[model samples]
Target: MDSKLNRSVIDISICSRSISDQNSSETGKESHEKKFLDKNFTTKRHLKSRHIQLIAIGGSIGTGLFVTIATGLIKGGAAGLLIATVFWTCVMLLLTSAVGEMVVQYPAPSPFVEMAGRCIDEAVECAAGWNFFLMEALYIPFEITAVSSIIDFWRDDYSAAIPISIIIALYTAINVFNVKYFGESEFWLSIGKLILCVGLLFFTLITMCGGNPAHDAFGFRYFKIDPFGSGYVTTGGLGKFEGWLGALFQANFFVVGPEYISMIANEAHYPVRKNLSTCFKTVIWRLCLFYIGGALSVGILIAYNNPTLVAANTAGESSAAASPYVIAMENLNIKVLPDIVNAIILLSALSAGNSYFFCSSRQLYSLSKRGFAPAFFQICTSSGVPIFCILVVIAFACLSFMELGTGGSLTALTYITSICTKSQMLNYLYMGVTYIAFYHACKAQGIDKSTYAYRSWFQPYSAYIVTFFLLVLCGVQGYTVFLPGWWSVEDFIFYYIMIFVNVAIYIFWKVIKRTPFRKSSEVDLVSGLKEIEEYEYEHFKIAEEAQINSDTDSEDYKKKNAKEIFNNVKTWIF
Candidate 1:
């Protein structure tokens, strides 16, 4: 084992040296500006493997799973909603696999945008960067609105402004302090959410088995009675189809942003194959347990035609009253559980808001670094906080206050949520397309995909499939607005505005810059790959030296495992 490990280290060192030599011979001079090996100017690598895992779990499981699943149940009934959620969970897993391949090789802040510039076109990078930034910015208010609504469960007398202000202030402080502060906060918050989700699932099972005060087991009762819902705007086949589409869109919201995990990976302490592969491996389970399982549980617990569900839908309220979980517990006369769930829901919203601030700020910082935004946005504090970018994103959180007015907050939340959903879909579409470009670029460059550190399963084929599906989903997401006599100009604009905005940005930049699609052979993978190889090789050298030194000290070496000693040495150097 020792001999094999030593040989592996030697091989990596040789490969690193070869790449460095080739790059030096071709460029004549190394490009320091392109190298991200420095710690001072780059974002700090303070996020650990655990931090990234929780980020993936927390970012994917948001207010949508807890509150918005009710909307899907109302539209598509239990069976339809469950089917849609399961199908989309599979879609998201494919998307995550594609992204993990690229991110593992070239982890960077806002990786998708950076990859677009390298493997596709600069215009694509610009468009994707701004689209994602705007999407995350708008989502801040969406989560803030959720927080306000969750607070309604406790007190209706207080103004929404009070809680909104407190949440905005708290998350902003967390972001402005340091990257580890944000990661640690998110790690614990995600744990809270995970605990709540597991508890909910367990409680759901007990409720279904007649453990409730009512003693009325609801074992697939809703599913057997009414599998399909009564229709959305119209009444027959077309309406049911529309309802199915609505549920599909809601599912998209639940799992739309796992790419955020990759974005956060850029700051991870070990942004290499092991860290990323572990993160992606957990994605399938998260999809099953948190998304698909959550949807199925909601369907089992709450009937589609329940009076509370109808009233909640008609009122268009975002409070705990609108949540099917609360409604189900109320029906079972489970008094304390509803309040407890409502509080957990509040924390979920706050955790999501924290994530929104982190992602949007980093998006701006990445854009600034790429020269697509003002240079001031590139400035980071001594502790590696992007202070200016965080402030800009926090300023947008003020949009939450629009709720204090006469129906103004809900109106704003409606438009913003629609726009956000469309924008997030665009991000997913770009990720799929970008991964395809990366795969082709690798092949064109004569790099063997099979030997890559983190190879995706279906490769170019999966990318192609996900890309096509995302394109279709983006176009048809607003199909309900086109139903005869159901056209509301407001609804139409809200649903489709981001699509137009994305295309307009792409075309405007393309025509001005004449940025054409990059040829696969000409893609610039060498610069980033050199930096990554150099960093990895140095770590390998350190580990090898540490092992050799430890072997000489037989007494100490016998007391500790080889892996443990190596890890301790690596931690010290890192």
Candidate 2:
């Protein structure tokens, strides 16, 4: 092993020297400018602070929280689900802090994937980029399928094909326009979802307090009935453990992709720091209000033994009926509210699908920028849309039509959901590991953490903790397959294929490229800093000049007040 490792090191050293010598032919200033231009080629900076702030909320709260937590409730029970959610929320918060620190310092199209190259190895970056790209691509269909399922809650008479096609077309058009359009659409959609979530929380509290016509105060009724769930696949301590695992997996799915915000940071307008800080802050609140609070409310409102939940769980469906909000309303004979909740679920699904298309296209564009994909994907229109990448990603929307085939949308959704969960788990594990590498690299390079734009508390310790748990969770997320009489070949493959694909990609690239992980001291943290520093300096300079101009121009006083009024309104809405 040591001999092979040494050989790998020598190979990478030789490759690095070859590349360095090739670049030595260029003038230093020319090389620096070319590197900066090349890194940002084709992508435009059109996303404003408001776009990013709202994206942070829109990206994290999705159909999983709105619809799929029912599966967690059925499998993990109320207490187990809540505990798992809180635990994973803490884990996600740590991850957000770690990733946020890196992104604020060096915002890139695919922030974590790019960081993986610098912090780990080029091979890992290649693997991580493609892995993330595929994950996002597959998620497109998953969200679209979610839309179909939610529609099913209303009327099973119409085929899903019509709505799926319409949704694909609508979001595809939105994405093809420009980043601003996508961001604005997501912002409003997210606001709608947030309002719905808040409304549901209030309604749950009221129903629990006997606000319904049935006058049945359901406060703690479900919790008292069944706290740990109907036993995972059996009836004992092992089942309770399994239930906890199920809840952990559900929570994982709910908040898997907050890193999407960092990815958008690359295209955001200047003042990335403020946007990132606001994004992280809002993410914390969203998780608390939407995920943890929603989970608790669901547990209190609906028993795990509810037939609707059992049917939804058995079918692996994410429909409105499966939603605790809808189920709770149904218990109170509140017919009108269920339809409203269903509409909200539909909006949540559509919003998530929109984001999936946006994220997947950007991931492909990032891969192209990094040389992991064909350069053609790097092509952009005058409007700064990655037209080719968008086209390629939208092409995958055709997979949504597979729902019309054997086993139907539910089967496809189950399969896609399983793949997406595992793929995202791999991404999270990579993030944790990358942060550790970054933390150590900072020390090795004599860079002070105190100087970081967004320093996360707990340093390398948080990285270690998050990384450890991610590893354990990923390893055991599919333990249900091993339960007696529960083994199924399809189930095992759906759950583990992403892990296998991730490993295969990494090993394939490592062997073909002979890429060796860099030593902590050798990691290049300075390459992108020059451009970022220049941008930051120029941004603040412009802001200062604007302030001075505003102060000096007496005639502009009314204009400034008017602008301030508009700004206040914008702040309130966003």
Candidate 3:
């Protein structure tokens, strides 16, 4: 092995819950011990399984799938459905496996960037860190852009600046309260979204069962009419494949955030290995329950070519007729409820924004801890919140409102959000490579199997398979770039900018500051979780033992039957 690699490998073994020794005055946080982290720097583990599950569900239900999938359906048709599903399935598998490997092995904050530091070059680590920050930071603007677009439901004229300011204020306030506050907020947000989805599903079923008030119980007939009469609306034809492919691709991107499961590594009460194992197993179910159910319901109830799904009607790029569910209700002559459904969609968007803000702040904190970022980011508030980082994230999100004046609101949002999405994929790619290296290092060091909290079901093969999928998706994006006006050069501008910007920053800092990438030994894995698992097991074990003993026999039983109780006591003690 190279001398540098040797140093990193050795560092990994001796790594502890301490930051790089710096003057306490520099960080502005309290002193840190070698074992537990500084109290000023610790985050609260307040998130529960409900918080995690709903966040996952919230991730799956985004505007991308709720509104944007119609565009993909327009482009690819029924065939597009299969393509989008397959592509996303592969993406999800790759992300889950790679993230699963890291969280299981390290279970720390900012696992993506840290893994980049380990598996690839350090330059890549810095790149991944900022890339992730940029992705989340930019999301603030993209989401605000949607808020403005949705406002068009009532007003023809809209101003982006006002809503942008309001969103920033809202995000900052919600995040600064405490981590649990954020969790509770997301829980309610997910509930609103789920109710909307279930309501839509019910409307679709009512329509399908031949109960339309206006259109003669149309059943599957309007699906053929093309409400707009632009032609080519049915799902069965060969010519509609491209339309579906486009919609499917968009759906794949929309459903990209479910891996938010990994973010809870520090807070989840149970072992990460156990929690993540349960999470990964639930991944397929999440996909089916949210995306499959939501999409199929929309497609069956509303025609693909519904004039409302078209971009022209909404004054933005194609959306599923605002809330396509509302359009279907209107088509069926159901009044007094479309407005309510629209309100629910608005809340869902906010919920997703809330999720993005939380994850982005945590990512910032994690990056700072590794010396990949400045120590200012390491400062946490009394409630274990990263106040400085939270402010910075809200600032970036506000900047994303620049798209409001543009004509293509949805397209603009899509363009910016796509960059963030692709950046996420880039992080996943590096994660796969990192896990491969981590796996080999463990083997080479002859580390015992017991050390790993959770092992990926299939080892090197699964890793390689996920890697191949990532490469293909990356290539597909590149190929899409050269296809004339069919693809937007501007949509991808952020992708290149993010990569170039990160590289420049890394090279400048590395050369001047003399900060070189360390070997695996230098990496710190135990610091993030701070031995929460050990604490839980040690403190909880005795209670568990007593509970088991008490469940079988009590003090009254012992007093009532001395001989029998004495025999039982002897057996228990022995």
Candidate 4:
């Protein structure tokens, strides 16, 4: 056994001769002696900032923006929009900052999940991973149902089964290919959605100003009729307030993908810190243009209380051709343009479904790699894609088609999507807590400040604010479930069932495995300390050059030389 091990090491050295020569050339030192290496690990960095940025944009622009916000608009009137926008802005600030700080530190695959394990506790990691997996998986059916409804706009009498099948098949094909291909497809789809949104914004502005190119301007006559009346424009209780809250939540839901960018940290090139920072910066404009623009356009042109808008909201058919955008376009007499917009909605939904597939599969893949899931799911194809995990995702997505076949299709679809949102809210709250712990862990360890790429300002305060608001939203959602005669107790039961299921899973796994909670210091410090050595070694030449330029005396040079000498010695030892 010892001989075999020695032979393996010798062969690996022969194969990595180039790396050894390069290291020796830079330091002008003999490096024939081989260092120990981890036999089970591999580094594969393939993502670019463009991919990260577009993925962020794609995360924010989806069927929820084009359709679901109508429910909120119908409920809260304009105030709902104000509340949602404010809530979302605050949540994003906390999430973006928390996630941004973590990614810069460790820069790994499935960042949030790993951080949850290392920073908070292993059980928290399990909760977060499964929550993300279940939430994203739940969206598959909602997206399919939504696309099927959108397709029915033109067919009138068409059955949803045909469209649902076609959408499932297309989405599966895209995800099964490869990550780069998946990204390329997402980029183009994002472009199409961006163009469509920009066009809608400009067209709505023109119509409101009474410049119909062929008719008298509608002006703001509709606004004066009743700014908060019965439908999309109302400002009452469940009628207006609920409607706007619905829209606000739906808009925020569409933009949830920005955090998923953290999952790709291991695949990103360049300085992981700088690239992660660049990736997060992409969220600001995406929210501004997609969510804000889409909501405002719906509010201004379509009477807030339009009959069709009310019907869709009450029926939860925001997925249908009766969406706020469609209602507004049809009111303008734009010929076949409403149908065109409906087609765009279907395309966008399909895009979102593709993303859900990718995220869910990758989440499972990450879990498997960490021993939390079955080893079979860790298998990656030659392209570095997790083929087995992707197949499992597609299988679950196909199950979502049941919504189209059921009598309660609309409600079922909305419930499933709502569950997805609820699960994510739970994950966000956990992330906030984990981030706070991670910051303090560094301080306790006396880790050098300069080594950290980015620091989350406001510390525990920012995290606390985010966690508090999330709990409030959860409370609001729960309250709505039992609003006297306004809501059914069954709604509350179903919503809480999903949360209970996640907790149940965590508790069951903990007891069955008899796993004890590891202290923060005992936690695997992948980003906290282990990588510091790797980074210094990788950038040794640069550090050497920097030190040489900092001082001119031979003694200072000797001191710098001693530092590098010690680093090299430490690298060779433990």
Candidate 5:
């Protein structure tokens, strides 16, 4: 009994001393989390609701929608393309809904990566951080190279280097500056992209109804081409199935969902809960209206076997001139509009690269702040820029210069697209995994998800379904290389490199760090919850104080509330 008391006393004494020496106390399990949230004080919150919504909209409308889309139709045929898009977009919606469930609760910067570490394992976190960083950073050059393709459609006189240098310079200027400027620029860029999407859909409707010079009422004439188009590697029904699978692969690169949307959380203005909730809720329609609708319109505009599209593919051309929609416009004898479309496509690519640059840097920042990377990456500038992280990403962005070689960047764009697709696929797969673990964590901790401010339809089941499909896609994503005569060693490498790399990362970290597979019961939900709660309460108190003082701020508040409601309704319906 005396020995036991002595041991207890010694433990108490140590605890008292450790508490006094806060630095020593921080070396426990929560060490990484101790200063993890100090970034809240460092990062500026300037992105308003409109900025975030537009940014979210812009993230989905990348160069893929405008440039690489015809590649989908080329491989999958029109029907296969439409069906593939529908399949992936639906899966993405469900997966993002799972991500939304957590983002609503945390609202930290790049908090999805944090969720993986907290709910699953830190090793997974390390893998997620680096892999996600790879995808986002690489997306930068991919877009620039896409811009190279689009710009080349009009001119081959200039070396790609000059334009690439200009674009890189512009990207550097935008990202190194304040995020508010970035938000505003993206808002306008996204506005242009939205107009382009709607305009093209309208163009499809008008032209298909005999509104053009030809007055050809080609109502789903393309649908007669087996509705699924010809197959990639073979002929007949199996080939059509291959075509559909190929379209699925193409669509995989195009649809990066909630993960992209959640990147702005740390830099968004007050009332993050409402802002992120609106962002997630709107993703449903964003996918449908933009991607699925685009697919439908493209299927109507041009048959997969049109001579122009066939010849463009035969010649290995992937410029704006080769876009199915642009080809349709040219076929209809529409003169100036195709140029306009190309212009907007160029802007769309630029916006996407810019957004990716911003998100990737923040992702790196999230890693370092969480102790998964070097501490220097955690340093933020007065403007809330992660300078070191941004520099690293900018350095990667220089990969665009590789396309400046004898051949154009179009070929490089294809390979980069494949890599980015695999990275995104792994991200989606883990997002579902992280959500399931988070679901269990919520249950294990006695937290009521039913009372969440934002709850997506379908429970853990959606996660299960998405994860299974993603796994199948990841496994077979490189199957085309195995097809007879379709073999290319380079294609195989770019296609499946991310999968191998992601596994290697997880294994290496697990072995070296000895990071335990954290059980759901041991997840750290409370670590960041208090900060978010404090943020929300501080916001609430300001309003309460205004009301108590009988300031006109109360009336302003009501007006703002009414405007917010109207905006929410408009956003949902649109």
Candidate 6:
């Protein structure tokens, strides 16, 4: 529902062959137009700039930040958690820049997946498509399980099956019925997420400064007392290093990057490509301020060794009182606000679940359109909903029932976090590789970077830097499983399985298809360019006409324009 490769894994050398013939072949129809934009074949473009931007921000801000930040605080302490947030935020910035450039030029269905094939290799495309598909598909259950666990904030125990069944039905109804419902619903939910984020951050700041009933002024108290944690199954510098690693992996769960935006770019049809660029540009700061600032605020609000948090972690509870923020609020005797926060956080979970449900189905649809998945998945309703893809994801939604077993939701949350986080980072890694290929291809083919629909800062350099760190992070996150007394077959599988599977898919496609790497000069930059340009202009005109008709009722044009500007700015910041 939310967020490929056609490049050779090896043979990094640039090809000397000219791709001047590429345009002649770029007549662009391997029937991709029919396969993708044929509304009968794929979904419609109803997501506006606000819808795309909010879906991404809301998706990234859910249980990972609100429900599970305590895990980071428990395992990595204040210092480790804060460092991880900052580090991942930077990675998000760099990765978004890399991917944003690609999306600007190619706004196809599953934009990056398509670009990978054209610029890199079809083999890379297939592997990327499936990895991405799995990444989003698996997240649907993880979020639903989280929704159930968040319910533990109120009830100690209930049949997780009840909520799971209800949510699955709702997901089917929304995704199978009309995409406008998806976009509009996500838009409002995202608005709620925005309000909740602002409120929580303010709550943290105020309570930390002795603004609560207790007037404790616990500013940086935890940071001073327990800056770093002694990590799992180890000690000394190694333990601290492992603590940081745990924090990094945990942080990765929250800071979803530009790829979420890329997933909905074709749908945004927001009428202005520049605003899409704005969406990409602003996302980094939004994440930085919300996530990094939240981690820092958590550190200032409470100590890592708080009794409530320790007990909850020991019991594997993902309830409201289990959250470090809620614990801090409880200690201050500020009882009602924690409940409010929890309620919003629950809505936050529902919103996130819906967005992921939407994204996973779309991603599967994208794969089907590209022929990486079965053809039946390519069939969409007249309303532009991919019924089969939605059904496929729903079929897997039953995995949420696994939350009923053993450690319950918290256990499942941890395992799924490892898989989904690394899978997301791997997608980022694929993007970096894809962008590098794209960058070189642009140079080789005499296409100036400046001429791109949008330009990201520190281009090829950002790509190179992101590539190094992501590779290191991806390989190292599973280090704990190998340590003495820490081996978990299940955790190991969740943590590292995506990496192996991603590699296997790439290799399998490369071998079975015998797909050769595209020469840098031979990349299909021209295919679909005209269609994208026309679509953008058409969307703009339609939106402009709508704006004019709406404005016709205003008694005074200047005052109305001022009010509109004030509302937009107010909404943007607060």
Best by lDDT: 5
List, in order, the clash count of every candidate structure. 1, 0, 28, 27, 1, 16
Clash count in backbone of candidate 1: 1
Q: Please write out the lDDT profile of model 4 over residues 14-97, one tens digit for every residue.
A: 547658867766785333223222222233455555666666566556787778767656655544564576568657766777
Tens digits of per-residue lDDT for model 6, 113-169 = 888898899998998888888888888887787777777777856687888898888
Ranking by TM-score, best first? 2, 5, 1, 6, 4, 3
Q: Better model by lDDT, 3 or 5?
A: 5
Residues forming the 10-long window of minimal summed lDDT in candidate 2: 32-41
Off by over 4 Å in 6: 1-41, 156-158, 270-272, 405-418, 539-571
Query: Model 6 residue 354 lDDT?
Result: 84
Candidate 1 lDDT over 1-574, as tens digits, reads 9858866776787777879978876775456435432324557778877778777777777888888788898888898899998888778888888888888878878887899998999999989999999998989988998888888878889877888899899988899887999988988888778878888999999999999998988788888746768887677987787787788888988866457777786687754657777777765566577787788998998888898888887887677788888898898889898888888888888888888889999999999988788988887776777778888998899888877777765676678766888888889999988888888898899987676667787767878888899999988888768877879889899889887888888898899889888999999887666556556666677778988777665876766777667755533221
lDDT of each: 0.81, 0.81, 0.63, 0.67, 0.82, 0.78
Total backbone collisions, model 6: 16
Assess candidate 3 and give its TM-score to the true structure: 0.77
Please provide, for model 5 over 167-227, each residue's C-alpha lDDT reduced to its tens digit, 9 standing for 90 to 100: 8888888888788989988988988899899899999989988999988999899877768
Pick by TM-score: 3 or 5, better one: 5
Q: What is the lDDT of candidate 4?
A: 0.67
RMSD (Å) per prediction: 6.1, 7.9, 9.1, 10.6, 7.2, 8.2
TM-score of each: 0.88, 0.89, 0.77, 0.80, 0.88, 0.87
* Alpha carbon lDDT at 540, candidate 2: 75
Between candidates 2 and 3, the one scoring higher on TM-score is 2
Residue 410 displacement (Å), model 2: 6.7
